[model samples]
Target: MNAPYLLPAMLALAVGTYALRWTGPAMRHRMRLSPRMIHLLDTGALILLAALVATTALPAGTDHLGLALPTGVAVGGVLAWRRVPLLIAILAAAATTALLRLLGVQ
Candidate 1:
């Protein structure tokens, strides 16, 4: 937390992160992933993304989950799955959330 150590710490972290990012591409040609491993990784990514969405959409400090946020997210997800433009999907989600809230659906 000291001011003097902050710069050095940040630099070290940045270098480490860069090295990690570079490692994957640098080793990609040398390393081979099995089909099962690839499938697992894809599934893991989807699961993580879903978890992030759930946590972000769920209301805080509440005993019961609200319908508006999840409904909006579902609408966005459906649009995205149908290959709709990202901006439109996002705007539709926001509009859905606003309308639900205005209708006192929380």
Candidate 2:
């Protein structure tokens, strides 16, 4: 009977996320770094991406993670790693997720 602030909270989150994303490219050219530092930075970026992917692809729960999302991500990752087209990889992941969900998987 008291769910009033959800929309605002979500909008704020969206704004904050976009702000950080936008600043990345805007500040990218302004920053100066050594070649070694640049390589390390690139590695760090990839690590961040991996972490994001993991968190999203794994279903979150209070007690345990679910199997469906992770399975979909695994399929997608392999396809991507094998140099499959991006659209195909994404569609495969989506389809896997949908199928699992349709089967009432947690």
Model 1 Cα lDDT, one tens digit per residue, 19-38: 99999999999999999999
C-alpha lDDT of residue 92 in model 2 = 96
Cand. 1 TM to true fold: 0.65
Q: Quick one: best TM-score, which candidate?
A: 1
Off by over 4 Å in 2: 45-75, 78-88, 92-106
Which candidate has the highest lDDT of all? 1
lDDT score for residue 64 of model 1: 84
How much is 44 displaced in model 2, in angstroms? 3.4
Question: What's the residue-level lDDT of 42 in candidate 1?
Answer: 82
What pairs collide in candidate 1?
none
Q: Give all TM-scores, in the order shown.
A: 0.65, 0.48
Alpha-carbon RMSD, each predicted model = 3.6, 5.7
